[model samples]
Target: MKKNNINDNDIILEDLQPSHAIHLYEMMQDDRIYTYIPENAPAAVETLKEKYKMFSKGSLRKEEVWLNYAIYLSSEKLYIGTLQATVQLDKRIISIAYILDPKKWGAGYAKKALSIMLQNSKEQFGHFDYYAYIDTRNERSINLVKSLGFKCVEYIENADYFKGSSSNEFVYAKISNK
Candidate 1:
């Protein structure tokens, strides 16, 4: 995968790197960040570094291309969180996901970052459908995706088993112009 570091007026999307592991671990330390996700925060920065290495090698593995970025706020000069796109090249489909520091909540940073990311993705790969799988209980995420024009296409039961229990998830999607 070609690494592209995209800069916007408010935020910069930098390719995920080993240097970001510590910041990512700190940003995701809050349990609230993982409330809706199937995976919990990494136990340590070392683990996160290993995971980042794996993600960097995603394209070589040939299963799917995982484009991961660390969200940096230019104004604050801080690493806020992360954004990822799981691209299925064979199907020409992309699934987007993101996490932001709870401290930055309600600041409209996520929306701005996503807007820039979408524009960049479209430029690099052309028009393709985007999807987001969110837990039904995550009102913020559901609303966020809805605001971006993602319609709920399915309600999946027991879609994920995390923290020792199963949880339901909703599939939200947007079909871009071909």
Candidate 2:
């Protein structure tokens, strides 16, 4: 794959790098950010290293299906968060996921990163639709996606919650290319 620079008024989407590990780890340590995300554990230096190694190997695999991006502040070049998309090759659809640093939550970085991912996915993978699975109680994230024109299509009741509490899973979708 190729790396392309995605610039917005305040943030940039760059190709993921080993150098971003520390910043990502620090961001993931915030309980607010990792609370709803089940797959993301508390990010430690060692965990970051292992994840980077695994991602490297996964990227090289012929059957690998995910694309990951690192989000940064364009002005200060600070790593802010991550965006990931998985392609369903058979269905020609892409599912998107992202997490922004809790420190920067109200600043619109997540929306910018998501817009870039949607555009890039259309250009590179010919994906016309974008989908996301978000916890219903994550009002910020749900609002963010809705603000981007994603419509909530359905809700899966009592979905798998990371913590002990039951949480509704909302499925949101948007047409990106067509």
Candidate 3:
């Protein structure tokens, strides 16, 4: 589990726990979430809990770490989304990802959560270059990363086959000055 509790007043990101499985699973049931993602929602709450349990063990090795956080709204007392980041210390890179409930899209929650995650990652993982791989058809995600200063560096065609068709992706990177 994560030790840091990151927040920007309006939203807070805490360590993702098995307890969050139920609420998150409910949100994940929305098929729109899987449009660009290669994986479907957890088949069951138990499945998601088991996954979260493994996630709680933290990284097993020194060169890489998987960081996952659950986004919470204290005012509304609800779980709204999640943040996932892979810190590849050996490669000096960080891959950041996030998912928000479909009902909550366009509310700026993701931007705030991601901004906070990137800021915290700087302290935890140093100045590694940050990256995001988004499906070409995901315009909102593309615009979000661009607004955060990420520049598209590569276009990958037929990156993966999911939901019955092949997908092309844009590799966006926020290069570190260091």
Candidate 4:
């Protein structure tokens, strides 16, 4: 965890501390959660450590591929999961990705947290569109995004980079600023 200058009350989106790494590592223990993720199973502690190090090093700098945030419940101050956005500055668009603890699934935490992130990004980046790339098989996530106003733009075949030879991808978008 790099030295984070995030204010005590500014939602503390990124630059997570080492103390929070264990909780995040534990959250990755579920195999079902990694079904659509671009990584393999057995998400061990070392994997979490590597991810944290990569985040600390700010390695996703090519075109601002993505900025990851550790989602926390504001009232409980408990770490829920993560949200990320990949900004296409040329297009003035942002695509989002998120995951929550399995225990927290179906509780609307992902929706609420993602909504906050969308609003924050809109404020910071001015008028922009938001998009989501969801695994077609993940009906729950697809439905959740639809509920948030993202319309299905297209169904992509063999679109995922790390799919287990079984899943398809769908691109969805919500044009708020356009």
Candidate 5:
């Protein structure tokens, strides 16, 4: 429930705004980025605009909060991707998700951004469990989260029922000792 803007020396994580749609649309144009995600790459900026607006409004349920951040590179001065956390207030649990422009892959930006986001989440929510649901075939994402200490807890079958396709996914989680 605290303010969501997060910043580090190299990256800026800001609340998703309507104006970010164009940049976000550009980021999503690459088919490689959406290979494991539920939806295909967005075909139009309008779709991104609508999505951003909904994200800005956030969740209405009192105990649930949905936060989305448009990732910006401070050095490059560009909007590159998105990172989000869906928080369960009463349970103090957080589910983290993120996507980066495929062009920016192997640059370690996702790792840095996630580290900052996780630290911020812990500071804001105190002790909480972290979770990430990754497509079973997404080796990159699976390794990324695992490198961050998330362990696979469940194998979900045909769980990604989006865009006319069903794919299996794995639930990765880490319980905070705090």
Candidate 6:
């Protein structure tokens, strides 16, 4: 595995580190990106940095492993987003999560980053089910997962409530063969 970063298609999927918190936290401040996300949870840069430190170290539980990567645009020389994978070791499942700066939306950054992470995930954790839990109102994310060949396996009504929306979620999953 590449310890420094994984490069491809003009983007770099840098292994998540505490140092990335500053830019990421700044980027995430865009209100457009929080439509389906909890607005209150993003405490502060320091808090984010501390959380990232632990994520970089990995999950505290034995049954789960965490993998996070910061999406960097080589040409733009910026950190645009992040991808997170929570691997449930016992269940052989990888619960995927991701977020990109609203300004970078539809620029293909999320797709590329996710693809790279999925590939690297197989290398590090072996074949496992990759699952993305997306809010029903998030059509862009839902479409993105579908384009990546993730089938909607379940519809969870009231999975969460955030941003004045009673959230219904779609559990999307795709199995890894490699």
Pick the TM-score winner: 3
Collision pairs in model 5: none
Query: Which regions of candidate 4 deviate over 4 angstroms?
Result: 1-19, 41-43, 59-62, 74-77, 161-164
* Residue range 1-178, candidate 2, lDDT tens digits: 5556677667777766666787778777778876776665644788786776565443554443677778988787688888888777767667888878898998877887898778777778774578899998889989999999999999999888667677779999997655
Q: TM per model?
A: 0.94, 0.87, 0.95, 0.82, 0.93, 0.91
lDDT of 5 by residue, 102-162 (tens): 9898889888888888888788778889999999989989988998999999999998686
Return the TM-score for candidate 2, rounded to 2 decimals: 0.87
lDDT of 3 by residue, 27-83 (tens): 988899989999888899999988888876778888989888999987888899889
Question: Which should have the higher TM-score, number 3 or number 6?
Answer: 3
Query: After aligning candidate 5 to the native by TM-score, how far in Å is the CA of 103 from where it should be?
Result: 0.4
lDDT of 4 by residue, 1-178 (tens): 1222222352446544445567677776777788876775435767676776675555455555455678776667677787777777678889888878898899887877777777767766778888898888888899889988999988889775665475578999998745
Candidate that beats the other on lDDT, 1 or 6, i.e. the better one: 1
| TM-score for predicted model 3 compared with the true structure | 0.95
Residue 61, candidate 4: how far off, in angstroms?
4.4
- Largest lDDT belongs to which candidate? 3
Number of the candidate with higher lDDT, 2 or 5? 5
Candidate 6 has its poorest 10 consecutive residues by lDDT at 1-10
- Local distance difference test scores for all models: 0.87, 0.77, 0.90, 0.72, 0.87, 0.86
Error of 6 at 103 (Å): 0.8
Which lDDT tens digits does candidate 1 get at residues 74-113?
Answer: 8888999889998887787889999999999888888888
Better of 3 and 5 by TM-score: 3
Q: Pick out the ten consecutive residues of candidate 3 with the lowest summed lDDT.
A: 1-10
> Which whole-number lDDT from 0 to 100 does residue 167 have in model 2?
74
